[model samples]
Target: MEFSSRARQRHLRLAGDRREPYPHSLQFYQEPPTESISLAEFESFAALAEDDYDARRKDHISHFILRLAYCQSEELRRWFLQQEMDLFRYRFHELTDSLRQKFLDHVNLSFEAVSALLSGFVLRRVCLMLFKIVGLSDAVDLFRARRVFIKDGFAFVPLKDIDAIVLNNYRKNLSKALALTARSLPSIQSDERLQPLLNHLSHSYVGPDYSVQKNTGKISLEHIDALSVKSFPLCMRQLHKALRENHHLRHGGRMQYGLFLKGIGLTLEQALEFWKKEFIKGKVDADKFDKGYAYSIRHNYGKEGKRTDYTPYSCMKIIMSNPPSQGDYHGCPFRHSDPELLKQKLQSYKVPPSGVTQVRHNLFGALFNEALFLNFISY
Candidate 1:
């Protein structure tokens, strides 16, 4: 039987309810539809179309990314470079050796494959999206985007090896490295006032199902807002506000905020102007702006900053690859997970234990998002 509206309200209260045994009920879980193509398939497809990929690859994938995102700002470019350097210095080595090796290999392979498979028009569009994923405003920005890409590439090596031992070895090594990093980082035991928000923000996008559900209209913005209220951490709250209010956020959050702003309706010119002025606020000079910011926009937008590119709008790669850490806040959640850790974190946030297990189990199944639950119960 369909759950009554009252029953739904009661279940939701469980988020805050701490009574013994906590209430249990069968509620409709609304799942979102996923894109049909797999990452392997997408990569292979791009590899097959190498000639096209190269032409675009040469034209600068970072610019394409920024232009798409509507974030090709003079100010944004400087900040991006600065952040890349900062992250590279502080967090690169935290990655596992095996994972790192895998990343280097995959990048070489992926590059060669794409070069061989795609070029020209086909490459341009595909790169447009990939550039965005790496947090570049455009294809030209990739040289700087390299650090982030390298870091994430290792984090997301698709286990295609037929050997179980090799695959298991890869998994264990990566997990230990990530857990070690998480443990070593200073715990954010800030005031309780920030705890609820911090926990929410930290956990918010952990599930693609959340985004999918909203896009498919199975869940309303109200529900999303509610989820955000609990899972939205201070970092994300600031991010959400920056994107929604059109303010430029500094440090590592700019690329994310910039892309999100584009998602909500900011324009390229507007976004650029906003970021340029923001960088200047931190004492950057006009000369730096011209060489760095202006250059990125022109190179990425393809018309000397006069045109808007669609790079910033592409979120799939970033969302599917990087997840947040002490320094890697530019990534998305659906892509990164530490199996046991993901479960514990979800449960702590009041997600039904069953839901947590279900999500973890379905992470690698053929289908993703809503398609996994077509005709299923509505959350």
Candidate 2:
């Protein structure tokens, strides 16, 4: 997330600002650009022309700023990696053949050109002699596009499709570096000034602030069950399900789901009843709820405590922070916990249990595809 200084400044705010090529230094530099670039300048320079040093500097500095901010967690690292790969592929594709070769040389990414890609039939004797190994074509984007030709276990990757090699290499290196950076993050976190700034950037919300709700008190409590199934996002639908079945949500779930209900026009009086009615079903009585959970629900509407009326959490905020712990049913459905939890949930969804055991790497994905998410909306 961008800081206040960059609140209005989109790195790619310019209509033409979509290129991914940034300076690749052998070392990660600690000294960022001393001067600040305005939003107008940023838009003008978003192209990062090689001849223009200042434009390049803006791109380079912003890259480091985000790295420091996003290097805190596995989820953040994955998100950053995906974004970087997207930009990397974009910039690479925009290059001319000569420019592409120059970039390959500059980045020192050595792609083994196969006989199909070469001008003549010349096979590297060394690769031929070795045991048949897979190419860097394992990268999902390239594999999906059929850019990689595999015969007898060897991936014959063409020059036009060399992006797979580059991205695969970059992904490995960046993932390792992010992990290392996270390990050394405690030192950075020790700096009180820097810690909050990093936290803010990592959890930054860039879209419209949903804090303002003109349609408050419009949604009736009776309609929530149907509404959750019909219109709520996957994260909220899961929260709704958990709240109803378990009759309780932890602090994290309450904050995330409660703010959403408030934002969607549930009034203060309705909010109190909604939570109280649900909470009383399992553990708390009506009187206990009024004394306990009611204040917290009102607090979300700026009625108590700090009286800070919080907005509904943006999708980014939900993805980046407060990952659900054991017995918690809030957060990305696909990113939920151990095999036991997965098994229980999969069974609840009526997904075949056999598929869960078969999915070794991405257990949640194979079963919970488009249909499952559609169920969240269609139900």
Candidate 3:
């Protein structure tokens, strides 16, 4: 049986709708001026700028450039920055000294990228032409903080590079998955009114985590597992495909992405609304959705921005890499890749499984409880 078959069955039983394909150009969207800064230059400048990067005030210039550079709108950047700041404050201290130093080193790269954007390095453009210049993976690398989460044996990259790949992957797979969605959930209605919402959920919303955390706190095991199962729809189908086929992550990687998305504001109501729209009959009873899926998304998204909304860092990577424990949700591959272990997991994924370490290993890298989380969020 194909992995999607299992996932599909699980999804259907869990009340997922096979959504219609999103009608969108599969092109990378980016502004031009933001693309001018070279990775080397961005890193060099970020190293110098972090010391000067002010935390108290919004660096409008830096913020603006990043908005353009990443080809995201300013509103998106503001929300992202707010999320990142909140995450960093919670997980910063939990990071090992080595990870902290490494993060600080690359954080400068992020600063430089932002600075370049603020300074008008990129100009507006039709295609994300700048992606070719820097590569999509490199962009995500510039801001990803997962490397700081684990203790050893992995490679790390800057967040700028990481975003590039993640965004591109999302763009590519989202369309493909949407195209196949109708077939996937054939029981659903062709004229479903909710198709647009499904398209939005499947296509527009999912991407990589570039935020950092400032401290670490107790992560509940039950919460971790619940979010793990709940993450499928909120995460892109392609990512879901990658994790299940990849094996090792029946746990780790799946949980990580799930929790991370929860931490970032993808909510249960939104998720349910998304799924129901894709149903074949254009009908998903509210009571059924409530009984089966709604509660988990609520638990995952957490109480309307209160600190109660929590997901563990351990489970997030399942969407990014193989599970650390084959089927358990306790570790991150990017941060915890033991060479021998990685080989086994890779083998399971049919990914050579040999000395195959560090396919953007550094892409790896969160934290805290509610009352304390509130303090962090307020800051």
Candidate 4:
């Protein structure tokens, strides 16, 4: 079964849209595929034999198949470009060392023996091209952050830096192409079958569902304290700590953290006891706890209201929705916390500055991008 499943996935990847070949020219620009392809693709393509027509055709056709779905919206286009770049990088890495060097030469980016002065001169020209292609804002951000260095008013960019530039260029052209495609989508939507398939593909999950859990009853209330210290995600850990220290949590915090505790295997009775004990120790007396908070706790456990077994919040959910208001510690710190406070919190947690920077970059680059993309699609 596993073998068959793998074979099916491989087949789908290589032979996308097997029903009929797209009759129209779907190429985004007049440039030949070799020149128009991303830098990563250029490297991988260079490694292939000249007569490998079947492999080349497969690569060409796959792009158009994706374009069909991805051209539906700006968000989908961005996602498709990222996925293609990732695929290109994987294939490029698989090339032999000699082939990789040869690819550099073929792309006119043989950086190893170039003098620093020459490299800087080349990079300034490349940066100009990038600014024209990707616009000033994105070009500046991409170059300033990675794989480029500046000295004495000129910039030096390695071959690796060219990958980012090429990807950005491809993305810009693709965005324009998608706009053209979108103009034609109304006519294409007349096809009842293709319409649904295109819609499904556009909204499909591109990454793992982080909310999934194989075992729901693995943890017990007795061990939650130790687990929060050692195993909880940062958001949950902070919520746990806040609850412990204050002996109470606001409604937002309680809903967010209570669901988490329930998902980790707290029985309804145990959860009620836990919240009641903590709340009574603070502002809420036993009567107030029973009157106001108990129902919500039971509601989260699926015993009241709609009886929905509400899942614990995923990272994306925490980052993108119902951000913590003042005094609330429930939402994503990366999205909601002040930068200086976030820095101090990370330092207090003994995270190195570099690690903190990396965490911030990953959150902003991946999570925030996804959130924005989702918003684009939904709105």
Highest-TM-score candidate: 2
lDDT of 2 by residue, 301-321 (tens): 999989898788766666656
- For candidate 4, the per-residue lDDT at 55 reads 49
Candidate 1 local lDDT, 17-136, one digit each (tens): 532221211100111113253434322221112223333232232222222122223333333233222323222233464553454344232222223233433544444432222212
lDDT of 4 by residue, 1-379 (tens): 4558889988776656542232221222323233344424422331223224444554564465456767777766665665555555444544575665565455443443335235435655554432112223434546568645545443444544445554455566666776777788888789785677677655544454645544566666778888876566667878999998999888888888887787677778889998898888898899998999899988887889999877776665565457788888898675567768876876676666666654544332344433432332211
Taken over the whole model, the C-alpha lDDT of each candidate is 0.37, 0.65, 0.35, 0.61
| Position 278, candidate 1: lDDT | 60
TM per candidate: 0.28, 0.54, 0.23, 0.51
Ranking by TM-score: 2, 4, 1, 3
lDDT of 1: 0.37
Q: Model 3's lDDT to the true fold?
A: 0.35
Tell me the lDDT of model 2 at 75. Answer: 79
Roughly what TM-score does model 1 have, to 2 decimal places?
A: 0.28
Worst 10 residues of 3 by lDDT: 19-28
Those runs of model 3 whose alpha carbons end farther than 4 Å from true positions after fitting are 1-239, 242-255, 263-270, 273-289, 304-307, 311-326, 334-341, 344-379
Clashing pairs in 4: none
